[model samples]
Target chain A: MPLNDQLPALNREFIAHFGEMGSRWGINRTVGQIYALLFLSPKPLCADEIAESLEFSRSNVSMGLKELQAWRLVRLRHVPGDRREYFGAPDDVWEIFRVLAEERRRREVEPTLTMLRSALQETPATDDERHAQERMRQMHEFISRLMIWFDDVQKLAPETAVQLMSMGSMVTRVLEAKDRLTGRNTKKQSSPS
Target chain B: MPLNDQLPALNREFIAHFGEMGSRWGINRTVGQIYALLFLSPKPLCADEIAESLEFSRSNVSMGLKELQAWRLVRLRHVPGDRREYFGAPDDVWEIFRVLAEERRRREVEPTLTMLRSALQETPATDDERHAQERMRQMHEFISRLMIWFDDVQKLAPETAVQLMSMGSMVTRVLEAKDRLTGRNTKKQSSPS
Candidate 1:
């Protein structure tokens, strides 16, 4: 194969793998491929260019772009001296991560939280129903706490979040040091052992 | 509706909602429904019981159980004097979360890390390829750091993790306090501004 042929082949491999990975994360293959293409492109690409390069139908590309836009994963740009609308992924990977986390929380987590709250409002009239309600309460509390923490983390500057993440388990050491200074009982430490 | 009828109706609604939610997370509807059913059950349930309760075919229940087991989201138990296999979710919701995180890390994250590592090994033949390679490296590093942090958190006792999560943004405040004590420059605070 020519060098040019090899390059597209390699790009195709990456695109295909991304599509498969996206399916595992509840995204369809086409959208994943489109996002992968945009992410790897050196410049913004118009719909026609994307359709031609990926050999997707023009309509398919249009719909995929719409989906990507709804997810806030792709941005629209207009090139100088060009009338066509072009699409590209954000240059910063951390921005993409932040958008994904925020969108998923909005679309998936919030609805479940609503459901749990409504379920908990009902009075249980039987032993079985009471048991189920209790389970739901436990689930509700767990999800609520997680979302609270997530919301706080989302508020952090991406760089700060990165710093905290890079600290890894060392954050635990810091927490321990604070506890020692305050003379707080670290009873929970017993559970990990 | 009769009281008995009303109870099952409510349970069914929760199960159906969970199935939908599961699909959004890349789990098939049947597996999600099965797991939800088991999670709410006060006792371990046999395959026949599961099939009858969910009104699914026996084979469907079997396949769902297999998938759930592979995900490590469900466990098998043998009842006294019974030949049939019974299934149940972990009694503790946190334990379920731990299993899911570990299994996904093994099945999904590890493979992607391997791919990124191999992709990085090949020298880029052009400027565009080099830029793409650079983006790939950024993605790889971000994912690796995340996995490291997750691994550390996972090692913490569930109680400790809960405590940490409940602290929410207070943890960030703690970090800032530590920074002041150590005189570290917090340049990233401007990003969120």
Candidate 2:
């Protein structure tokens, strides 16, 4: 039942592509394939079942599952009579997206930001060093700006976030309207009697 | 001077860190170092200069430049009276960021979207297949929503986009205002009808 004999062609293809794409990203190929398998399985699968279904070694499957768990991409469960633990992906794709985004920001973006901050704190000994520090400041500012926006989006209720995203290009009109209102206020404050 | 005798310690540290970080990313260590060198150099540099300064082989330098060029992360120029092409990154970090975002979307996200589309087109033969298809549908919809928002952001003039991102969490207020207006209109249209 856990994708052993009749792993549909659709699921197989999906799993295979994810493996290939996973290597391109930070995740290893085997780990990516393992995640894809868990994601598509109709029920939580124990280690042995996953190993046999994907034709991977038991140790390999175990390692992949451990990696997936660290990514928060898979969850573990236990059956009533069975000693073995099973794993499955969260059912909600948006949850998966949120986890991936947050993890990447934490692991990759945060370190880069720290590096940039330390670089900026140093006093430049030359004009060229000054220029480099300036570039680092620009990079830092851009990432910080993005993080602030992302934080706001992260705070929104999932449905509201979806609604906001669905608004898409229409959000620009709202921006424009806000700008007009702010511009008029500034004009009124500056006008002479 | 092409940083032969007086490569700043600041530049050296920045280049080394970028190389380390770049390997974590898709780019190779040497290539990332090379790009960092070009990015911080006061002027465009020739292959020999890059190779000698970085202590990398001419061939490694050549390959790295080629990779950077493909990413549109570097530009080629000719110094007057010098036949060899010189390389430099865009002076504008925002331009570099925009190019990176666009290139990544085209290379990674677009292909995944296409794969999802093809998978969605296939008919399911069983309940299990239907469940797998449903998950795929959810994944596709989530990515599509993100893409729509990203596309609109990409279309904004760079300054405007910067301002919008700079607005940070304030953008949510706009979202709330838009929702209230739309909610009132719907109420009016349906009231006592």
Candidate 3:
């Protein structure tokens, strides 16, 4: 069926919601809706197909796909007889979780850690500023360690992440154990655990 | 002192990095820089103060302040006898994390869940289409449950979040164990163990 006829009003509303969500996460609304549509779609779709379905410009679809590719949110496919490229999300939702975790850590956490490192090296102007820099250093180190933990997490099979997602409150229990193991009670520890 | 003179080059570099990061996250670059600056500042700053320090337009500062307020990223302060509001990040970084989780869940996750619910109610045209709707149903339910878990996590005290952040790999290990207990072997289970 033609997409316009096949896609109901609910689909459009869902796509629009996703688009708005994309803006919150530092992506455009169109990109979010496009990805959401791809996620719901059973088959890989080409740029023209996506543009037509979403009522977006061809160039806009092109750019959205490009950005999605950079974020590793979409996969490219080539039909056996077709010359055009197609795009789709991974079948497993866990894969999306892994991608989001890894991408956010890279885009947000890593840079903050890097900044904290540089800031720590700078000479403080006075006692008060020195204390603030010290706090920044603590934040940097803490986040760096967290990133390392996430690196270990990414190594877990997609199935493993899926398992963890459903673990619920037990996740918090394990975190508590980890705190005791690390010997870090408060956020600021004078020395490494 | 001029910002160039008062703020070290490294500080400016970090601010610039955050500004760029903001664009990637859908936040205005100046707003990101302003937040980064606030994160590091020893004292709360007024909009005029931020404008003067960053050499940005006063109007930009106003818009940025509004955005920051919406994000719950900046704390409004009242200095003794002063009517002008001062803004700063929470003393604890985990507080920032909690606010981020809550706000994003409310703005992004809840709306998506609503859309998914509506989509689930739509009648499928055929058996194969029914199967597709089933997949979406699983996705929608899982997402809704996950949002609840995040809400629980967000309600946690900052001290607890910091403890978890500091736990590093141990938290993952516990989650791994929890995954085992939850019967995570299946590809898609509507009711997770």
Highest lDDT: give the candidate number: 2
Rank candidates by lDDT, best first: 2, 1, 3
Note the DockQ of each predicted structure: 0.37, 0.42, 0.35
Clashing pairs in 2: none
Number of the top-ranking candidate, with DockQ as the measure: 2
Query: Residue-wise lDDT of candidate 3 within B1-193, one digit each (tens)?
Result: 2244456555566667778888877788899989977877888999998998788888999999899999999999999999899999877766776687778777877777777787788898766456557657867866865666566555443455456564565435544544455456323334422
Q: How close to the true structure is residue B31 of candidate 1, measured as C-alpha lDDT?
A: 87
Residue-pair clashes, model 2: 0
Arranged by TM-score, best first: 1, 2, 3
Clashing pairs in 3: A19-A29, A26-B25, A26-B26
TM-score of 2: 0.87
Q: What is candidate 2's CAPRI-style docking category based on DockQ?
A: acceptable
lDDT of 2 by residue, A2-100 (tens): 335558889888888888788886788889889998887789999998898888889999999999998889999988999999999988776787888
What TM-score number comes out for model 1?
Answer: 0.88
Which lDDT tens digits does candidate 2 get at residues B1-193?
2334557777887788888888877888889899988888878999998999888889989999999999999999988898899999887666787889889888888888888889899999999889888888878887887787777665553554345443545546655554554553211121211
Q: Write the per-residue lDDT of candidate 1 for residues A40-102, one digit (tens) a residue.
A: 888899998888777788999999999999999999998989999999999877788889988
* Residue runs of model 2 more than 4 Å from their true location after superposition: A1-5, A158-170, A176-193, B1-6, B159-170, B176-193
**Would you estimate the TM-scores of all the predictions?**
0.88, 0.87, 0.80
